[model samples]
Target: MPATVIVNARWINEARQTAGGLRLENGRIATWVNDRMGWNGEQLAGMPKGPRLESDR
Candidate 1:
């Protein structure tokens, strides 16, 4: 289980542009964007069990 989830990250590094969600479990990255997509109002009914943090944009 993740303690926090960050969605729609537009992080840019020297290598490439990174985007998408990141799930942190136990102070570490447990899940990446490739594993799960951003959450939406439609998915609220059956949301995953965890605390998620998302941006307005």
Candidate 2:
């Protein structure tokens, strides 16, 4: 089974937005956003696969 890791990772989504939440996978960070606004399961599911970066910068 794939281990779902909840990391304080930073990312920018395709729409060019930012958000934060429990990261669930390890791959290429296709897109991401800030965590100011929360996300739902469906939204999280739509998030592009991305690799966890050591830092936001």
Candidate 3:
């Protein structure tokens, strides 16, 4: 699975001066952490019914 990285932001309960980061996998949140809080993915599932990507145009 491919992974995406995000930076330069605060997560959870934290002061405005704090910063945090996150990682995403399979279009779901994988992990999130900051100077004050942290979290990880438990389960991620896609919608059973949704618009097709090809029809987005």
Candidate 4:
């Protein structure tokens, strides 16, 4: 499976971990990306790209 970059992902908690993106690989989370836009506002590592997605809490 190819790695996926989930942008516009916000983790609201005491830790305040603003996980810009999540790198998913092999059916699991591979790593955390600090850049929400996915590497200089563009896709990197050959991950499929998509528009920013957000949800109300």
Candidate 5:
């Protein structure tokens, strides 16, 4: 599966602007609403997997 990087932002879609649920996929970013427009999910399966970050304090 490709890696998805979701960021916080409000975006415009189809002449209407909306907020919430914004995200970026396959190195390309867009609001959640526009994700289905042209998303091909490329480079997703090659993403590196690793353990969760730990506290070093």
Candidate 6:
């Protein structure tokens, strides 16, 4: 899976969770930076490399 970064993300549900950025590694969430308005955002690193697509399929 490709490393991902989502900004100003919100969740609409019973928990009503929110995050400044959600990170994913190996197709699963690796970390979540909680909601903070006016935030400059965050950096996620040290992600494990995923299987190369050319061989994965």
Q: What TM-score goes with each of the models?
A: 0.19, 0.22, 0.14, 0.15, 0.15, 0.15
Better of 3 and 5 by lDDT: 5
Say what the RMSD of model 5 is: 14.1
Candidate 5: tens digits of C-alpha lDDT, residues 1-57: 223211111112211221212233324444333454332333212222321212101
For 1-57, candidate 4 gives per-residue lDDT tens digits of: 123323233223211222223343322332333233334312434434333344212
The candidate maximizing TM-score is: 2
lDDT of 2 by residue, 1-57 (tens): 133332334224322222233333322232232242244434655666553333233
Cα deviation of 20, candidate 6, in Å = 1.8
lDDT of 3 by residue, 1-57 (tens): 122211212111222212222233332323332211232322212222232223222
- Which candidate tops lDDT? 2
Residue 8 of model 4: what lDDT?
33
Give me the overall lDDT of model 2.
Answer: 0.37
Error of 3 at 50 (Å): 24
Question: Model 1, 1-57: lDDT tens per residue?
Answer: 232223222222111112222233222332343234354323422433333333223
What lDDT is obtained when candidate 1 is compared to the true structure? 0.29
Candidate 2 C-alpha error for residue 45, in Å: 0.7
**RMSD (CA, Å), each prediction:** 13.3, 12.6, 15.2, 12.8, 14.1, 14.3
Q: How far in Å is the alpha carbon of 13 misplaced in model 6?
A: 17
What does candidate 1 score on TM? 0.19
Give the whole-model CA lDDT for all candidates, comma-separated. 0.29, 0.37, 0.25, 0.30, 0.26, 0.24
Better structure of 2 and 3 per lDDT: 2
What lDDT score goes with residue 8 in model 1? 26
Choose 2 or 3, whichever is better by TM-score. 2
By TM-score, how accurate is candidate 2?
0.22
